[model samples]
Target: MEAKVILIIVTTGLIWLIQLSSVEATQWHSKQLLPYFRRIKLDKTKNSVYQHTVKDAIRMHLRIPLMQKALCLPKGTKVSKHLQYADVSFALIILKSHCFHCVLQLSSDCLNRMVDKARQHENKFYARFTYACKTHAEYSSDCMESGRPMYYRNLRNLVKQTEKCWKL
Candidate 1:
């Protein structure tokens, strides 16, 4: 009986080892086949062109004018007055959430490029604008009472810190 039990245990162990080896072999075969099934790599020039195309598409889609409308502010309206509107706060919150998601979809390289473009246009306001919208969206009443300019400057500084932390 003792001998029989030992034989049974040995048989089970061998079976497990065989199954493990078969799984490893299958994985090795799949690894060998991967390159054939994968997408072909683009040259650096082509890749950069594609990246720029995508970034421009995102920028066009996420233009600040669209966000301004969402915040219920007309194109020529003063930001201070618009900030006081009850709907402005709600819109800003929604815009901030949407921008957070949109930005996440973009690569850090793309964001850096966008920042560079904004700088070249003397539009340092882009980052500050987004930050202010998000901050006021969060604390609408308090932000209005305390002052929009102060919050905007503070948020802009925060945006600068965040940009500094991003990988180049």
Candidate 2:
């Protein structure tokens, strides 16, 4: 009986090991078959042009020029012109921030004016405005009100929430 139990355990262990090895082998084969490259192939005329991802491009745009200059890229690397668009909606009264627990109370009329100001302008590459909300506690006030531009945090959670006494 002891030998039978030992044999069963060993057999199960071997089967698991074999399955794991086969999975690793399959992953290796798949990676070799479809390798991912940071630099994708562009048109034949501009063979070596690699475009930065939108998020990275945004970061590079927002960052200081000295930091941007420190990083070197291929001679013709371009920021991807393709932009992702979203129609974001915020509540009329309470504003919930993504992090740092910042909440702003505003009236509906005031919120409408704020939204009007946030509208994208024609011929402008970027909008130059942001909304400011007060933090719940003194601890998160620093993050809510940073020296850097509002785009640095980018209002991670720009959603509406219902709280005690808020507007807009």
Candidate 3:
């Protein structure tokens, strides 16, 4: 009889402990960003919409940040590699791939020329030449691929995403 009573008390205590744990779990909510990209820019400028746009682009792509052993990385990362020696990153590419969604506030034609010039200076920098319909038709079949941007059918959708994301 005593053994039975002890068992019952232990079971009751276990159940109560489980309930307490669940209650504690509910209070432990936290923000979730994948791969944990910590922003590295040291700039303190708060008035630039361009900076906000870049942040919005990162959010849209949902890119996993550079975790440990994230990606060995190629010598050339992207067109922006020419502009900046630092690798542009997969997160940045997936985020910034859209012409209309470009956070840099640069036109397709202008940016393309800038990329090409940069390539002239350093072959290591020229990574990719994205096909924008408004430009790059003369040298690329991709411009004629589907009456859309070379990467995705997403010209309109990209523009829409950019427009909607502008407020963020």
Which candidate's lDDT is highest?
1
How do the candidates rank by TM-score, highest first? 1, 2, 3
Residue 78 in candidate 2, Cα distance off native in Å: 34
- For model 1, the stretches where C-alpha displacement exceeds 4 angstroms are 37-39, 47-168
Question: For residues 11-33, could you state the per-residue lDDT of candidate 2 as single tens digits?
Answer: 99987666555433323322321
Using Cα atoms with residue i matched to residue i, what is each candidate's TM-score against the true structure? 0.26, 0.24, 0.21
Could you give candidate 3's per-residue lDDT for residues 42-129 as a string of tens digits? 1345324333433433333222111101221222333331111133333233322222121222233432332233223222111112
How does each model score on lDDT? 0.37, 0.28, 0.30
Q: Which candidate ranks first by TM-score, i.e. highest?
A: 1
Q: Which residue pairs come into collision in candidate 3?
A: none
lDDT of 1 by residue, 1-168 (tens): 999999999999987666555433323332332232122222254334333432343233223332243332334443432222343444444443333212212234534543444333222222233344455653244434334344334434433443444332
Evaluated at residue 17, the lDDT of candidate 2 is 67
| True lDDT of residue 111, candidate 2 | 32
RMSD of each: 22.1, 20.3, 18.1
Count of clashes, each model = 0, 5, 0
